[model samples]
Target chain A: MPGTRARRSDAEVVAAVRAAVVEELAEVGLGRLTMDGIGQRAGIAKTSLYRRWDSPQAILLDALQAGFPQEQPTPAPTDDLRSDLIEALRLMIAWLTTPVARATGAILAERARYPELAEAVYTQVFEPKGGRFTGTVLRHYAAAGRIDPDRLTPVVLDIGEALVLKYTLDSGELPDEQTLADIVDQAVLPAADRPH
Target chain B: MPGTRARRSDAEVVAAVRAAVVEELAEVGLGRLTMDGIGQRAGIAKTSLYRRWDSPQAILLDALQAGFPQEQPTPAPTDDLRSDLIEALRLMIAWLTTPVARATGAILAERARYPELAEAVYTQVFEPKGGRFTGTVLRHYAAAGRIDPDRLTPVVLDIGEALVLKYTLDSGELPDEQTLADIVDQAVLPAADRPH
Candidate 1:
């Protein structure tokens, strides 16, 4: 029983540290993130933090990557590209309501003030997670020969997520299912080679 | 000479107060905005602010609408829809680098906390300034019979600004000339009825 408690507590400490980095970044911003602050917020010793992570930024990056969602595009006899794009956007909308999403927004909103942190987020978190929302699905379709490779430009791939983001930024609300369907049918499908 | 100075000082005071509202929103955020903070920042009397505006949100809305740029879709013999769409995005990029833009970001970013303020930004600033970037151009071309009116759906109209905002959020830099053109050619034109 004592040994089980020791192993479980180790996992708990790691989870606490991950959550603390996000909360810390939100409170102090990327510029003022400190190891001590993270440790205090997680209720761990500062030395314990240094043992695992070299700095506060590293821990934050680890947290972001750990929490970042991956879009799953299932291969089927009847794979629907339109439905897939909308589904990817739905994943994005769901992510928007999370603590990690808020942390990502915090880092990005002040990106002009803290360039390297933002860069690290891209290189470490988003890039490894499949570039951007809807990107994975597009790539999946392209690989399966369902879509023309030429149509999968960066701008085309970004249409669904981008419009959903703009909608949220303008309205302060997550897009509804109808909005997602509209995005897929009107903007995304046409650019993804499904012309009109 | 004294009369001219009095008239100039009055204009100067209004300008200072307008600038102060944006700066105060940046530092104190929307919820913390107050007459005392704005007056102290602008170095003016609180009574002077209330003379023209009823609340801090009122001043923010007024300042935003004052600074908001209108999209100008010029008519030429050729009247290139592609170039006009690109130009509209260029205007949006230019606006993205301003103090007012950052103030707008602060409001929209915290819109989940202040829904009314976000809605006010739309009704007061953006809708009056041609809905969204690329919106006026699409409408202009549609009205001129260069584009099909039915193609001007909300999702299609949003493709350009949404992509630019997503690009900036991802890369922490404004989209380059090539990137903007890609958005037009790959995304905007296709949705606007170009149909490659």
Candidate 2:
């Protein structure tokens, strides 16, 4: 009995651990994150957390992969490019302001310490959620020969995400309805629509 | 010695302190920045630093105002909006990747702790430098009746700067000539040009 292993390898434990990491990260941020604290928060034994993950960064990478919304919400197909882009960008704005994305501010600040984690967040989490807007919606528009081919690249796609990020960074919140409309009406629509 | 005031108003001392803050911020970033370290780096006393500024945030605000490039370089005039926008945005790309802009990544990371400092840096350093591109160059083009009046606003202006910042954040450097050209050609020009 003294040497026997307890019921481990439960998938629920993995989910709990990941949720604890994310919750702790949002509250205390990455600088002060600790496995002992995470184990406590998750109500799992310290030995359990240590057995599964090598470091806080390793857990963070797993948590990020789990915590991010698995699928970007598909925008409804509207005949108008403007409506489709607006809906897509609104989804992008909401995603950027999520607790997970907000928590990454701490990671990005400590990028020098955890370069791999930062890069993973950018590549694994951010690019895909943000990238789907262009890949799915804009690509469809371009395929219909509605948008200029020049506007189909990732660089052009960055325009909307960057605006939302910059606005949130400045104001500490997602932009309002008027601002989103301005982005879609004045920038996104103009930049993509093929000349008649 | 206590009776008499030491050389209290030397511009050189203030300049040295500000310069030291900027240099240290670039090298070690904000998390490791310390008043003692700044004093040592500036060859000034801790008492002197404390006397001038209440906290590191105060010093950072001062340094940001002093550190950013005062004027955005004006590109040469060209016949077409494409050439003009390309040259203007090239200057923008260079300006964005400067040490001062790169250093703000640290402040941005710790935005919760020092919101005012972040706002000050944004309003004073970033807005002015990034603002002029839209206010001056783009305004000139609009004035010439080459572009729509509705396009001349702060929101639309953010697209170019935001794109540059995103590219820098992702790649750890400014966009290349091809990327810059793509942004200007596909995004900026299309958004600004008027209908025939």
Candidate 3:
């Protein structure tokens, strides 16, 4: 096995390990994710894995943190809040289709069994990636004085994500482009927009 | 068993059957729920159950229909969109704690396996009572000419339930009163209120 593993570069080994963790999370889930299992899947040595990370959860969290997508708002505030917000949601929907998102969902579905790991997902994965889908967009405009900064309360920030997440949960499908626009125009913008 | 069941009123039998379905649903979920199990739990005969309902899912849908709560807006609305919204969200949180809620969650968690039953949850249990927790309150005020009727779009109406539902999904607990108030003030009311 060592001879077959070859002298792969450190970057190559890290990339392989990251991909393996995504698949491992979906297949084994929160429980039963072991260093040995990950090592075998990534074609790396368990001793080598231990040299870099301590636990399987740690490795999984690293991949999630690395894979989480950050939303971008348009540069120099065009005063078109609607388009920027919709673009942010589009980024979110695109990310929702990835292997990393599935891995995140897999961990969340077992929140009761692995409460700490679930918390880690929020703090380590989601929070660092803009908290919610429209958060960056809302905050970006708020910072530009186009929207009231005080209006970016947790509930306000959550409107787009909550509705979009609710739709996905209820329908088992991500919101379409029109649905995302509906969320932005009807929910997020109304909640976050400054009064005329 | 027959001796004990003797002389029971139709209402009494139906009540027993209703409670039995709730418990049966939690234990066996949608896939394994059966007439035999329900009859035994309710202390009614399988033939008696068949006389009332043709399928176990039908019996479950009936119980859910009976248990869904109807949210009440302030009789006059009194221009208190905030308080009414908070109350409506409170009603939703209360429903989420019921055994019927657990049954619904069990069904929804396996939506891929029982897609039709999940749809039935929406059309049968949820829609008849109200589309969302805040739907009745929003429509009531709109009818009174306070909020714009057009503001009560799908995303607007869903603001309360979506945030409450998302909160519960993340925390594994229902939103407290203060958080409900945040949802009203920060998200729901702003989206539903008439523009000045």
Candidate 4:
């Protein structure tokens, strides 16, 4: 397909493409998602699609990233780290149970064939959101003089990664609110407690 | 490819096919794996392979089940749930970093085409081991008059699923022992602490 006289900016193109991909995914599953299909749906030329995103996987990653809330809405710290962590977990669980999470699983299934796309999605989208949430919670604990700042990264990564993976692998039946509360109270909050 | 002399029993055929699947997955990654390849590797007729295992996914699931340790090793409870959990985590980390984990991931990638295989592997391989380990620790805690026995399943599933998923999604970078220790100390032990 040839480009029209009206040229869209890169951001506009990306946004359009991303929206089309999601709509396509809902209509036709991941197996049938193709660049040309997405291009047609987005009213963009296939050439334009390929020029920006290397493959359908890249486009799908872009779609997922765009779908998630860009700014991590700061959960007001409750002073009690356990409550704060629970709040974060609740929001994450809700997100994971949404359409975005389904699309993520579909993308992950295709990841082996497109390792670069997988890396891009992980680093650009999933990791950043996860890191931000983890960082904020850990920072709150550190400010209270409860946990060593050094322990933040590893703890957050381990727990956050685990939670996300569990939900994904389980096909989005996220841990219930009670379980989330239990996890924070039992694991996360205590881990932040000042050492004897 | 017709068998003349007494055909092998279904069990024997399943064993041969499963062994061949493992060998192929190990030698050639998931992308290159095929029914013909498995048949040739197993010294079985292509027809026999197709007839027995519905798809490559089925073959891989069978292989995973065959490879999984028959007995879920019970972690000896040292009356200290934390240490027991740490030991369990160590064992889990070791398993996840091994060839078994790699094969499991390969099998998982094909889950969309073979949903049954995913369920079978989850039930036969993952769930049983996780259940036994958690049960052992929880039983010890129960015997000591600590946490409620009813809570064991949810705890085990949440934590076990998370741990395994983290390892899988992270592409085999096993969480360090210290991280595992912290998880046990904070989550498992505290959850098992006697109710005041």
Q: How many residue pairs clash in each candidate?
A: 0, 0, 0, 0
The candidate, 1 or 2, that scores higher on DockQ is 1
**Which residue pairs collide in model 3, if any?**
none
List TM-score per model, in order.
0.87, 0.75, 0.94, 0.64
Across residues B60-101, which tens digit of lDDT does each residue of candidate 4 receive?
Answer: 876776665432224445355566667666666666666666
TM-score of 1: 0.87
Against the native complex, each candidate's DockQ, computed on alpha carbons, is 0.73, 0.49, 0.76, 0.28
> What are the lDDT scores of the predictions, listed in order?
0.87, 0.71, 0.87, 0.65
Writing each residue's lDDT as its tens digit, candidate 3 over A7-38 gives 98999998889889888877876677899999
Q: Specify the poorest-scoring 10-residue window by lDDT in model 2 chain B.
A: B69-78
> Could you tell me the TM-score of candidate 3?
0.94
Which parts of model 2 are misplaced by more than 4 Å? A1-12, A26-37, A45-58, A70-80, A126-134, A143-150, B1-17, B24-63, B70-80, B96-99, B102-111, B126-134, B194-196
Off by over 4 Å in 3: A77-79, B4-7, B77-79
Show the lowest summed lDDT stretch of 10 residues, model 4 chain B.
B69-78
Lowest-sum lDDT 10-residue window in model 3 chain A: A1-10
Q: What is the TM-score of chain A alone in each candidate?
A: 0.92, 0.75, 0.93, 0.69
lDDT digits (tens) for residues B49-147 of candidate 1: 889889998988989998888887876786888888889999999999999999988887777788888888999899998989999989988998888
Candidate order by decreasing TM-score: 3, 1, 2, 4
Of candidates 4 and 3, the better by DockQ: 3
lDDT of 2 at B53: 93
